[model samples]
Target: MNKFVYWVPAFIWIAVIYYSSSTPYEKQDIKPWLGDWVNLSWAGPYLERISFTYNNQEVSVAAQGIAGFIEFFIRKGAHIGVFFVLAFLIYFALFYTVQQNKNKPLLAASAWAGTVLYAVFDEWHQGLTPNRTPYAGDVLLDAFGGGLAVFVILSVHRKNGRKKKFNIE
Candidate 1:
């Protein structure tokens, strides 16, 4: 019962994000959101700050980087990357939380499965939402997100191990 309770919130939160992301909003609402995210947050300033002049126009390096890297490649397909990231991160979170305890592998796998399923369902939910169109491209992003989480967590583990070896030697 205790372990089940711990698992409940992770699944619920991921489910909520999955469903909500699929819900369509007015373009007016979306525009502000995009603006707020890319133009108002720390990313906004960071992007704006790292600009360079080209043809008398100061272009944000961060914006260019994001566009050229994350968006450009991702636009080619949905479900190729980001959604996986969502899944992977969730798995990493689950594993990290349970690292010092028992049943780490089972808990991690369950979280990973939940994340991937959530992405799939999220795409389905998008199909039903108004003003939103389901794109396999987004699903790709989700997958990428998951893969990235795996990369990050694994990297951290490796780094810590290396650091411990260095200290001992």
Candidate 2:
């Protein structure tokens, strides 16, 4: 892969994230989230509600076993679950930024590192906001999501992830 191929998209995503996501953290007017970006609130809640409807009792049971554990940490001003899922998606979606390259380790590390850094910056951006305050728990949740993405990319696809081999003879 050409250096420009990877770097360009990397920079573009960074810029897009920096401009779009962080600013919202800095000033959560809610009009956007409530009126224009209402989809933000709606989508997140919708995903959860739909997931619940689909799973029903199984979700409750699983939540009681493991997901319910999050209750111990959740509180006002911090939505850990939302942040986690958002991070997971951000990282996962970002995977499309680069085409497959020869350097497996580098590519994996870049994807993960970008995710982790994005989480940190997102929190910092939130810190600058008045209505929204940055929470360490959120950052941790973000990291957890990012970490999960790595596993997902590796494991979620079974028959599709072809191993690349280099001829060294």
Q: Write the per-residue lDDT of candidate 2 for residues 1-169, one digit (tens) a residue.
A: 4445535544565565555444643353333334343233333443344224221233332343222322223322233443344444444444555456634445445566766777688778866755555666566666666566556555544324443233222
- The TM-score of predicted model 2 comes to 0.44
lDDT string for model 1 (10-74, tens) is 56766666656665655324334344466434444445456555334444546454333223333
Question: Which numbered prediction scores highest in lDDT against the true structure?
Answer: 1
Clashing pairs in 2: 32-37, 63-68
Query: What's the lDDT of the predicted structure labeled candidate 2?
Result: 0.48
lDDT of each: 0.56, 0.48
For model 2, the superposed segments whose C-alpha errors exceed 4 Å read: 21-106, 156-158, 161-169
